[model samples]
Target: MSAHRMSDPLDRRRFLTAAALRGATVVGTGVIGATALGAVDADAVFAAPLRRPLDPAVPAGAFVEGRITSIDGGVLEVAGSHGDYARVRVTGATSVWKVRPTTAASIETGDGLYARGVPMPDGTVAADAVWVNIVNLHTTIRGIEKTRLHLAHGSHEIVGNLLPATSSASYSGAAPTADLSGLRIGQGAQVLGAWRPSDDSVDIVRVAVGPGAGHRR
Candidate 1:
Protein backbone atom coordinates (compact mmCIF):
# COMPACT_ATOMS: atom_id res chain seq x y z
CA MET A 1 0.00 0.00 0.00
CA SER A 2 1.15 3.53 -0.79
CA ALA A 3 2.47 5.64 2.05
CA HIS A 4 -0.25 8.24 1.36
CA ARG A 5 -3.21 5.99 1.97
CA MET A 6 -6.81 7.11 2.54
CA SER A 7 -7.58 8.54 5.96
CA ASP A 8 -9.78 6.77 8.48
CA PRO A 9 -13.46 7.81 8.13
CA LEU A 10 -14.10 7.57 11.86
CA ASP A 11 -11.18 9.82 12.71
CA ARG A 12 -12.16 12.39 10.16
CA ARG A 13 -15.73 12.41 11.40
CA ARG A 14 -14.58 12.92 14.96
CA PHE A 15 -12.27 15.76 14.01
CA LEU A 16 -14.98 17.55 12.05
CA THR A 17 -17.45 17.13 14.86
CA ALA A 18 -15.00 18.59 17.34
CA ALA A 19 -14.31 21.61 15.16
CA ALA A 20 -18.02 22.30 14.70
CA LEU A 21 -18.61 22.05 18.42
CA ARG A 22 -15.83 24.52 19.09
CA GLY A 23 -17.26 26.97 16.61
CA ALA A 24 -20.69 26.75 18.14
CA THR A 25 -19.26 27.23 21.58
CA VAL A 26 -17.39 30.34 20.56
CA VAL A 27 -20.54 31.78 19.01
CA GLY A 28 -22.63 30.95 22.05
CA THR A 29 -20.06 32.47 24.40
CA GLY A 30 -20.66 35.87 22.79
CA VAL A 31 -17.49 36.01 20.78
CA ILE A 32 -19.58 36.31 17.63
CA GLY A 33 -22.96 37.74 16.80
CA ALA A 34 -25.25 35.04 15.44
CA THR A 35 -27.94 35.49 12.86
CA ALA A 36 -29.87 33.25 10.53
CA LEU A 37 -27.06 33.80 7.98
CA GLY A 38 -23.67 33.90 9.76
CA ALA A 39 -21.71 35.29 12.68
CA VAL A 40 -19.71 38.51 13.00
CA ASP A 41 -18.05 40.15 15.97
CA ALA A 42 -20.22 42.89 17.52
CA ASP A 43 -17.28 45.23 17.84
CA ALA A 44 -16.65 44.95 14.11
CA VAL A 45 -20.19 45.06 12.68
CA PHE A 46 -22.03 47.70 14.81
CA ALA A 47 -18.91 49.82 14.92
CA ALA A 48 -19.65 53.06 13.11
CA PRO A 49 -18.67 56.65 13.75
CA LEU A 50 -21.35 58.92 15.10
CA ARG A 51 -23.08 61.17 12.61
CA ARG A 52 -22.13 64.83 12.92
CA PRO A 53 -24.55 67.23 14.55
CA LEU A 54 -26.71 69.35 12.27
CA ASP A 55 -25.38 72.77 11.34
CA PRO A 56 -27.65 75.74 10.96
CA ALA A 57 -25.26 77.22 8.39
CA VAL A 58 -25.89 74.37 5.96
CA PRO A 59 -28.41 74.69 3.13
CA ALA A 60 -31.75 72.85 2.84
CA GLY A 61 -30.31 70.38 0.28
CA ALA A 62 -28.60 68.56 3.13
CA PHE A 63 -31.43 66.64 4.91
CA VAL A 64 -35.14 65.91 5.35
CA GLU A 65 -37.58 64.26 7.80
CA GLY A 66 -41.23 63.20 8.32
CA ARG A 67 -43.39 60.59 10.03
CA ILE A 68 -43.71 57.24 8.21
CA THR A 69 -47.44 56.60 8.15
CA SER A 70 -47.33 54.10 5.29
CA ILE A 71 -44.79 51.99 3.40
CA ASP A 72 -46.85 50.63 0.53
CA GLY A 73 -46.14 50.26 -3.21
CA GLY A 74 -42.59 51.42 -2.71
CA VAL A 75 -43.79 54.78 -1.47
CA LEU A 76 -43.45 56.52 1.89
CA GLU A 77 -46.19 58.67 3.38
CA VAL A 78 -44.58 61.50 5.30
CA ALA A 79 -46.24 64.50 6.91
CA GLY A 80 -43.71 67.29 7.31
CA SER A 81 -43.17 69.31 10.46
CA HIS A 82 -44.48 72.40 8.70
CA GLY A 83 -47.81 70.64 8.19
CA ASP A 84 -47.01 69.39 4.69
CA TYR A 85 -47.47 65.74 3.78
CA ALA A 86 -46.45 63.97 0.60
CA ARG A 87 -45.98 60.48 -0.79
CA VAL A 88 -42.41 59.86 -1.83
CA ARG A 89 -41.61 57.10 -4.27
CA VAL A 90 -38.72 54.76 -3.58
CA THR A 91 -37.18 53.81 -6.88
CA GLY A 92 -34.18 51.64 -7.75
CA ALA A 93 -32.06 53.67 -5.32
CA THR A 94 -33.64 53.85 -1.87
CA SER A 95 -31.82 52.45 1.15
CA VAL A 96 -33.40 51.25 4.40
CA TRP A 97 -32.02 51.32 7.96
CA LYS A 98 -33.21 49.91 11.29
CA VAL A 99 -32.53 51.40 14.74
CA ARG A 100 -32.90 50.34 18.36
CA PRO A 101 -36.08 50.37 20.41
CA THR A 102 -35.04 53.28 22.60
CA THR A 103 -34.29 55.35 19.56
CA ALA A 104 -37.62 54.57 17.94
CA ALA A 105 -39.62 55.70 20.94
CA SER A 106 -38.67 59.40 20.87
CA ILE A 107 -40.35 60.20 17.59
CA GLU A 108 -44.06 60.88 17.20
CA THR A 109 -46.34 62.19 14.49
CA GLY A 110 -45.68 65.71 13.11
CA ASP A 111 -42.13 66.68 13.94
CA GLY A 112 -39.81 69.23 12.34
CA LEU A 113 -37.23 68.00 9.81
CA TYR A 114 -34.09 69.19 8.10
CA ALA A 115 -32.69 67.10 5.21
CA ARG A 116 -30.23 67.32 2.37
CA GLY A 117 -30.90 65.86 -1.11
CA VAL A 118 -31.89 66.58 -4.68
CA PRO A 119 -35.49 67.72 -4.89
CA MET A 120 -38.14 65.89 -6.88
CA PRO A 121 -40.71 67.73 -9.03
CA ASP A 122 -43.56 66.83 -6.69
CA GLY A 123 -42.03 68.53 -3.59
CA THR A 124 -40.75 65.28 -2.06
CA VAL A 125 -37.37 65.45 -0.35
CA ALA A 126 -34.54 63.02 -1.15
CA ALA A 127 -31.06 62.83 0.32
CA ASP A 128 -28.84 61.51 3.11
CA ALA A 129 -29.48 62.57 6.76
CA VAL A 130 -27.73 63.58 9.99
CA TRP A 131 -29.54 64.10 13.27
CA VAL A 132 -29.79 63.44 16.98
CA ASN A 133 -31.31 60.39 18.68
CA ILE A 134 -32.90 60.13 22.13
CA VAL A 135 -29.81 58.39 23.42
CA ASN A 136 -26.09 58.99 22.89
CA LEU A 137 -25.18 55.59 21.46
CA HIS A 138 -24.03 55.44 17.84
CA THR A 139 -26.69 53.99 15.55
CA THR A 140 -26.49 51.86 12.38
CA ILE A 141 -29.93 50.51 11.48
CA ARG A 142 -33.03 52.71 11.01
CA GLY A 143 -36.45 51.02 10.77
CA ILE A 144 -36.78 47.26 11.19
CA GLU A 145 -39.84 45.15 10.29
CA LYS A 146 -40.77 41.44 10.30
CA THR A 147 -38.65 40.27 7.31
CA ARG A 148 -35.77 42.56 8.23
CA LEU A 149 -32.48 40.72 8.92
CA HIS A 150 -30.46 40.75 12.11
CA LEU A 151 -27.08 39.07 12.68
CA ALA A 152 -25.81 38.71 16.21
CA HIS A 153 -22.34 40.08 16.71
CA GLY A 154 -21.36 39.31 20.27
CA SER A 155 -23.79 40.91 22.73
CA HIS A 156 -25.11 43.21 20.01
CA GLU A 157 -26.37 42.41 16.50
CA ILE A 158 -26.07 43.60 12.91
CA VAL A 159 -29.46 44.73 11.66
CA GLY A 160 -30.77 45.52 8.16
CA ASN A 161 -34.14 46.79 6.98
CA LEU A 162 -35.48 46.14 3.46
CA LEU A 163 -36.02 48.79 0.80
CA PRO A 164 -36.42 49.28 -2.92
CA ALA A 165 -33.13 48.89 -4.78
CA THR A 166 -33.18 52.36 -6.28
CA SER A 167 -30.56 54.60 -7.86
CA SER A 168 -30.63 56.82 -4.83
CA ALA A 169 -30.39 53.71 -2.67
CA SER A 170 -27.06 52.80 -4.39
CA TYR A 171 -28.31 49.54 -5.92
CA SER A 172 -27.65 49.13 -9.65
CA GLY A 173 -28.19 45.62 -10.95
CA ALA A 174 -31.63 44.47 -9.83
CA ALA A 175 -34.36 46.12 -7.82
CA PRO A 176 -35.66 44.29 -4.75
CA THR A 177 -39.17 45.57 -4.21
CA ALA A 178 -40.00 47.08 -0.84
CA ASP A 179 -41.34 43.71 0.36
CA LEU A 180 -37.85 42.18 -0.12
CA SER A 181 -38.79 38.57 -1.02
CA GLY A 182 -35.84 38.12 -3.40
CA LEU A 183 -33.17 39.27 -0.98
CA ARG A 184 -31.69 36.60 1.26
CA ILE A 185 -32.19 36.91 5.00
CA GLY A 186 -29.32 36.83 7.52
CA GLN A 187 -26.53 38.17 5.29
CA GLY A 188 -23.83 40.70 6.09
CA ALA A 189 -25.03 44.07 4.90
CA GLN A 190 -24.20 47.78 4.89
CA VAL A 191 -27.20 50.13 5.02
CA LEU A 192 -26.81 53.67 3.73
CA GLY A 193 -29.03 56.76 3.51
CA ALA A 194 -31.17 59.21 5.48
CA TRP A 195 -31.86 58.42 9.11
CA ARG A 196 -34.77 59.56 11.24
CA PRO A 197 -33.00 61.47 13.98
CA SER A 198 -35.74 61.62 16.59
CA ASP A 199 -36.89 58.05 15.92
CA ASP A 200 -33.39 56.70 15.22
CA SER A 201 -34.45 54.86 12.03
CA VAL A 202 -33.05 55.35 8.55
CA ASP A 203 -34.53 55.91 5.13
CA ILE A 204 -32.10 53.66 3.32
CA VAL A 205 -30.14 54.63 0.24
CA ARG A 206 -27.92 51.60 -0.37
CA VAL A 207 -27.61 48.08 0.99
CA ALA A 208 -24.59 45.81 0.43
CA VAL A 209 -24.67 42.14 1.44
CA GLY A 210 -21.64 39.86 1.65
CA PRO A 211 -20.64 37.09 -0.76
CA GLY A 212 -22.00 33.53 -0.41
CA ALA A 213 -23.66 34.48 2.86
CA GLY A 214 -26.63 32.57 4.25
CA HIS A 215 -29.00 32.78 7.21
CA ARG A 216 -28.37 31.25 10.64
CA ARG A 217 -30.36 30.93 13.87
Candidate 2:
Protein backbone atom coordinates (compact mmCIF):
# COMPACT_ATOMS: atom_id res chain seq x y z
CA MET A 1 0.00 0.00 0.00
CA SER A 2 1.32 3.44 -0.86
CA ALA A 3 1.12 6.52 1.31
CA HIS A 4 -1.43 8.13 -0.99
CA ARG A 5 -3.66 5.10 -0.60
CA MET A 6 -3.48 5.41 3.18
CA SER A 7 -3.87 9.18 3.16
CA ASP A 8 -7.61 8.75 3.47
CA PRO A 9 -9.45 5.96 5.22
CA LEU A 10 -12.53 6.57 3.13
CA ASP A 11 -10.67 5.58 0.01
CA ARG A 12 -10.11 2.10 1.30
CA ARG A 13 -13.60 1.91 2.74
CA ARG A 14 -15.23 2.98 -0.49
CA PHE A 15 -13.06 0.73 -2.58
CA LEU A 16 -13.76 -2.20 -0.32
CA THR A 17 -17.45 -1.45 -0.34
CA ALA A 18 -17.50 -1.57 -4.11
CA ALA A 19 -15.39 -4.67 -3.96
CA ALA A 20 -17.85 -6.28 -1.58
CA LEU A 21 -20.68 -5.54 -3.92
CA ARG A 22 -18.72 -6.91 -6.85
CA GLY A 23 -17.74 -10.01 -4.94
CA ALA A 24 -21.27 -10.77 -3.81
CA THR A 25 -22.28 -12.26 -7.12
CA VAL A 26 -18.97 -13.95 -7.79
CA VAL A 27 -17.35 -16.98 -6.19
CA GLY A 28 -13.63 -16.75 -5.54
CA THR A 29 -10.76 -18.36 -3.71
CA GLY A 30 -10.51 -17.94 0.03
CA VAL A 31 -7.67 -16.96 2.33
CA ILE A 32 -8.81 -18.36 5.64
CA GLY A 33 -8.72 -16.75 9.05
CA ALA A 34 -10.95 -14.19 10.64
CA THR A 35 -9.89 -10.71 11.65
CA ALA A 36 -11.74 -8.76 14.27
CA LEU A 37 -11.23 -5.70 12.07
CA GLY A 38 -13.36 -7.34 9.25
CA ALA A 39 -13.62 -8.86 5.75
CA VAL A 40 -12.99 -6.00 3.36
CA ASP A 41 -9.51 -7.26 2.67
CA ALA A 42 -10.92 -10.76 2.41
CA ASP A 43 -13.19 -9.59 -0.38
CA ALA A 44 -10.42 -7.64 -2.04
CA VAL A 45 -7.90 -10.45 -1.85
CA PHE A 46 -9.50 -12.25 -4.74
CA ALA A 47 -11.74 -9.52 -6.09
CA ALA A 48 -11.24 -11.04 -9.49
CA PRO A 49 -9.10 -13.83 -10.76
CA LEU A 50 -6.84 -11.21 -12.32
CA ARG A 51 -8.34 -7.82 -11.58
CA ARG A 52 -5.23 -5.98 -10.41
CA PRO A 53 -2.25 -7.99 -11.42
CA LEU A 54 0.88 -7.83 -9.35
CA ASP A 55 2.64 -4.51 -9.71
CA PRO A 56 5.82 -4.71 -11.69
CA ALA A 57 7.25 -1.64 -9.99
CA VAL A 58 7.89 -3.75 -6.95
CA PRO A 59 11.20 -5.60 -6.89
CA ALA A 60 11.18 -9.06 -8.39
CA GLY A 61 12.61 -10.97 -5.44
CA ALA A 62 9.96 -9.87 -2.98
CA PHE A 63 8.32 -13.24 -2.59
CA VAL A 64 9.39 -16.29 -0.62
CA GLU A 65 7.42 -19.50 -0.17
CA GLY A 66 8.58 -22.53 1.73
CA ARG A 67 8.35 -24.51 4.95
CA ILE A 68 9.82 -23.21 8.18
CA THR A 69 12.47 -25.67 9.24
CA SER A 70 14.09 -23.60 11.95
CA ILE A 71 13.69 -20.30 13.76
CA ASP A 72 16.83 -18.64 14.98
CA GLY A 73 16.20 -15.29 16.55
CA GLY A 74 14.00 -13.33 14.13
CA VAL A 75 14.92 -15.36 11.09
CA LEU A 76 13.35 -18.52 9.74
CA GLU A 77 15.16 -21.09 7.64
CA VAL A 78 12.88 -22.18 4.86
CA ALA A 79 13.15 -25.16 2.56
CA GLY A 80 11.28 -25.08 -0.70
CA SER A 81 9.90 -28.17 -2.35
CA HIS A 82 12.03 -27.74 -5.46
CA GLY A 83 15.36 -28.06 -3.65
CA ASP A 84 15.42 -24.34 -2.99
CA TYR A 85 16.03 -22.56 0.28
CA ALA A 86 15.73 -19.12 1.81
CA ARG A 87 16.26 -17.18 4.99
CA VAL A 88 13.29 -15.06 5.99
CA ARG A 89 13.72 -12.34 8.55
CA VAL A 90 10.70 -11.06 10.42
CA THR A 91 10.85 -7.56 11.77
CA GLY A 92 8.70 -5.41 14.01
CA ALA A 93 7.08 -3.82 10.98
CA THR A 94 6.22 -7.15 9.50
CA SER A 95 2.54 -8.07 9.55
CA VAL A 96 2.28 -11.68 10.60
CA TRP A 97 -0.93 -13.62 10.08
CA LYS A 98 -1.24 -17.04 11.62
CA VAL A 99 -4.97 -17.68 11.92
CA ARG A 100 -5.02 -14.00 12.91
CA PRO A 101 -2.84 -10.94 13.01
CA THR A 102 -0.09 -12.18 15.28
CA THR A 103 3.58 -11.85 16.07
CA ALA A 104 6.67 -13.78 15.17
CA ALA A 105 6.42 -15.62 18.45
CA SER A 106 3.27 -17.35 17.20
CA ILE A 107 5.07 -18.79 14.18
CA GLU A 108 6.28 -22.35 14.59
CA THR A 109 8.65 -24.72 12.90
CA GLY A 110 7.10 -26.94 10.23
CA ASP A 111 4.51 -24.28 9.44
CA GLY A 112 4.14 -23.29 5.80
CA LEU A 113 5.13 -19.75 4.93
CA TYR A 114 4.41 -17.42 2.03
CA ALA A 115 6.14 -14.11 2.47
CA ARG A 116 6.28 -10.86 0.55
CA GLY A 117 9.31 -8.77 1.33
CA VAL A 118 12.49 -7.12 0.19
CA PRO A 119 15.74 -8.87 -0.41
CA MET A 120 18.43 -8.18 2.13
CA PRO A 121 22.17 -7.99 1.62
CA ASP A 122 22.56 -11.19 3.59
CA GLY A 123 20.39 -13.09 1.09
CA THR A 124 17.59 -13.04 3.64
CA VAL A 125 14.06 -11.96 2.87
CA ALA A 126 13.09 -8.91 4.87
CA ALA A 127 9.47 -9.76 5.20
CA ASP A 128 6.77 -7.14 5.22
CA ALA A 129 3.94 -9.70 5.13
CA VAL A 130 3.84 -13.26 6.33
CA TRP A 131 1.03 -15.77 6.41
CA VAL A 132 1.45 -19.09 8.17
CA ASN A 133 -0.77 -22.05 7.44
CA ILE A 134 -3.17 -19.89 5.48
CA VAL A 135 -5.35 -20.99 2.57
CA ASN A 136 -7.34 -18.60 0.41
CA LEU A 137 -10.01 -19.80 -1.99
CA HIS A 138 -13.35 -19.09 -3.66
CA THR A 139 -16.25 -21.30 -2.73
CA THR A 140 -19.99 -21.50 -3.10
CA ILE A 141 -22.26 -22.71 -0.34
CA ARG A 142 -23.83 -25.97 -1.48
CA GLY A 143 -25.42 -26.94 1.80
CA ILE A 144 -25.27 -26.05 5.46
CA GLU A 145 -25.98 -28.39 8.34
CA LYS A 146 -25.23 -27.21 11.85
CA THR A 147 -21.57 -26.12 11.95
CA ARG A 148 -20.74 -27.64 8.61
CA LEU A 149 -21.01 -25.99 5.19
CA HIS A 150 -20.72 -27.97 2.00
CA LEU A 151 -18.82 -25.83 -0.47
CA ALA A 152 -18.18 -26.18 -4.16
CA HIS A 153 -14.65 -25.24 -5.13
CA GLY A 154 -14.34 -25.51 -8.88
CA SER A 155 -15.29 -29.05 -9.78
CA HIS A 156 -14.90 -30.48 -6.32
CA GLU A 157 -17.25 -30.36 -3.37
CA ILE A 158 -15.47 -29.98 -0.08
CA VAL A 159 -16.87 -29.58 3.38
CA GLY A 160 -16.22 -26.30 5.17
CA ASN A 161 -16.09 -26.97 8.89
CA LEU A 162 -16.72 -23.88 10.95
CA LEU A 163 -14.98 -23.69 14.28
CA PRO A 164 -17.45 -22.06 16.60
CA ALA A 165 -14.74 -20.82 18.90
CA THR A 166 -12.75 -19.02 16.22
CA SER A 167 -14.74 -18.92 13.00
CA SER A 168 -16.46 -15.71 11.95
CA ALA A 169 -18.28 -14.09 9.02
CA SER A 170 -17.98 -10.66 7.47
CA TYR A 171 -20.98 -9.05 5.82
CA SER A 172 -20.79 -6.07 3.49
CA GLY A 173 -17.35 -5.08 4.77
CA ALA A 174 -18.58 -4.93 8.34
CA ALA A 175 -16.70 -6.23 11.34
CA PRO A 176 -16.62 -9.94 11.92
CA THR A 177 -19.62 -11.55 13.55
CA ALA A 178 -20.00 -14.83 15.39
CA ASP A 179 -23.45 -15.12 13.90
CA LEU A 180 -23.28 -16.98 10.59
CA SER A 181 -26.94 -16.58 9.75
CA GLY A 182 -25.83 -14.63 6.68
CA LEU A 183 -24.61 -17.70 4.77
CA ARG A 184 -27.20 -18.98 2.32
CA ILE A 185 -27.34 -21.90 -0.04
CA GLY A 186 -25.91 -21.27 -3.56
CA GLN A 187 -24.36 -17.97 -2.51
CA GLY A 188 -20.80 -17.23 -3.54
CA ALA A 189 -18.37 -16.56 -0.70
CA GLN A 190 -14.72 -16.21 0.09
CA VAL A 191 -13.20 -18.30 2.87
CA LEU A 192 -9.98 -17.90 4.73
CA GLY A 193 -8.88 -20.74 6.94
CA ALA A 194 -6.77 -23.79 7.29
CA TRP A 195 -6.82 -26.56 4.72
CA ARG A 196 -7.08 -30.07 6.05
CA PRO A 197 -4.67 -31.97 3.83
CA SER A 198 -5.74 -35.23 5.37
CA ASP A 199 -9.24 -35.11 3.96
CA ASP A 200 -9.01 -32.22 1.47
CA SER A 201 -11.55 -30.34 3.54
CA VAL A 202 -11.28 -26.82 4.95
CA ASP A 203 -11.57 -25.50 8.49
CA ILE A 204 -13.11 -22.10 7.87
CA VAL A 205 -11.86 -19.19 9.94
CA ARG A 206 -13.40 -16.22 8.20
CA VAL A 207 -16.08 -16.10 5.52
CA ALA A 208 -16.79 -13.06 3.32
CA VAL A 209 -20.09 -12.65 1.57
CA GLY A 210 -20.48 -9.69 -0.78
CA PRO A 211 -23.01 -6.84 -0.57
CA GLY A 212 -25.87 -8.55 -2.36
CA ALA A 213 -25.65 -11.38 0.14
CA GLY A 214 -28.10 -9.44 2.31
CA HIS A 215 -27.72 -7.72 5.65
CA ARG A 216 -29.01 -9.01 8.95
CA ARG A 217 -30.34 -6.57 11.45
- TM-score winner: 2
Give candidate 2 misplaced runs (Cα > 4 Å). Answer: 1-61, 81-83, 171-176, 196-201, 210-217
The best candidate by lDDT is: 2
Cα deviation of 44 in candidate 1 (Å)? 15
> Per-residue lDDT tens digits of candidate 1, residues 1-217?
1121233222211222233323222211222233323433333333322233233332233245656565443334676667777644332212222332112123333433333333444455432221222112222333336545443334665443344443122223344334443344454445544444444444444554434435332
lDDT of 1 at 161: 37
Q: Which 10 residues in a row give candidate 1 its minimum summed lDDT? A: 8-17
Can you give the lDDT of residue 126 in candidate 2? 61
Candidate 2 residue lDDT tens string, 156-201: 8989888978889998788999999988998888999976645767
State the displacement of the C-alpha of residue 150, model 1, in Å, after optimal TM-score superposition.
Answer: 24
Report the error of model 1 at residue 15, Å: 52
C-alpha-based local distance difference test score of model 2: 0.66
Quality of model 1 by C-alpha lDDT? 0.36
Cα lDDT, all candidates: 0.36, 0.66
